[model samples]
Target: MGRIIAIANQKGGVGKTTTAVNLSAALAARGKKTLLVDMDPQGNTTSGLGLEKNELDKTTYEVITGEEKIQNCIVKDLFDNLSLLPANRNLAGAEIELMTVDKMQFIMKHNLEKVKKQYDFIIIDCPPALGMLTVNAMTAANTVIVPIQCEFYALDGLTQLIYTIELIQKSLNPDLTIEGVVFTMYDARTNLSLQVVENVKSYLNQNIYKTIIPRNVRLAEAPSHGLPINLYDPRSSGAESYDLLAEEVIENGGEN
Candidate 1:
């Protein structure tokens, strides 16, 4: 069985999609058969991987709605050893559609079952909300990787997220666990960033990752070019950070 890890955070602009894209690429670069699932309606992960979101005919919406099979919806060769289940604005209606369906939270998990054995890791890029879509992702995942922006408001809403996770653990996925919390957009020069890191480490302790992702122009530019940091600028600090983060993820045994 492959590890299904949801890269999730309820807040936007926390490097969630960036982590999903780059981390998947890094894992594939290491020869792992990785699948990147764009669970977000915005389709950033799809577009970030050089796919034209608007040009896609089949996407995650169809898979979640049972209109298409998981294998038929997959876009392969986006990167070597990487496959993508793309998404687009069409997914915006899925939330409403799923509300009327039975066993709604289990839809994603059930769909993933058909293709779970083909990959070493399935990295799901969840939407920035604690809604049904995120719940489905959580219900499907073995664990979750939370990316927190290094700022004063960094810890806000985390308690609620954790509470929701516990609820899901009890009711949805009994084996669910938190992979780790990674600090993103870190700036060494800013005392506030350092303070935030110390604060999170003090509070979460072992739940936080030692690798901190620095804010870099290269990282921000990669998505525009439809590339991960490693492919965009392998020598950059942004690429280096994600590479180190990937090593930590692998060392921790990938959601085990």
Candidate 2:
């Protein structure tokens, strides 16, 4: 069976989608057959990986809504080992509609059940809110990775996210666990960055990753070209950081 990891955070602009796209790409680069599931209605992950959202006939929304099978929905990307279950604006209405449905939280989990064993890893890019969609993702995942920007009020959201994790663990998936945190858009020279890192590490204890993603223009620009940083500029710092982060994930998974 594959290890399913959800890249999730309730806060936006924290590099959640960026981590999902790059991590899936990097893991696929390591020869793992990976699936990148774009659960966010924004479809940023879909477009960020060079996908044209209009060309997709089926999406993750279709799968979650029982309109299509995951196998039929997965579209290949530039990475040979990576496949994507794209999402678009159609997903924006799912939360409200799903709330009225029976077994609401199981929709996404059930959609992925058939295909979960097909990949070495499944990465879910969750919407930036602690809503029904994120609940479903948490229920489906074995682990959850949070990408936090080293900015003002980073720790403010941390408390709420951790509390949500606790609730999910108690009520939904008992096997679910915190997969550590990665600091994004970090400026190494800033005392503020160091202070934020210290605060997060102190709070989370060992549930924080050593890899810190620096603010790189290439990372910010890659999405515009619909490319992962690794594909856009493999020699860049952003690409190297994600590559090393993937390596650390693999090592932590004890496969290295």
* Cα lDDT tens digits for candidate 1, 1-256: 6799999889999999999999999888888899999999999998988889988989999999888999999998678998999999999899999999999999999999999999989999999999999999999999999999999999998888888988999999999999899999999999999999988888774478888999999999999999998999999999998888888998887843
Q: Which stretches of candidate 2 lie over 4 Å from their true place?
A: 254-256
What global local distance difference test value does model 1 have?
0.92
**CA lDDT of each prediction against the hidden true structure:** 0.92, 0.87
What's the true lDDT of residue 103 in model 1?
A: 99
Q: Residues 52-142, candidate 2, lDDT per residue (tens digit)?
A: 8867769988887878888888886447899999999888888888978998987878878888778888999999999998999999988
TM-score of 1: 0.98
Global CA lDDT computed for model 2: 0.87
Off by over 4 Å in 1: none
Which residue pairs show backbone clashes in model 2? Answer: none
The most accurate candidate by TM-score is: 1
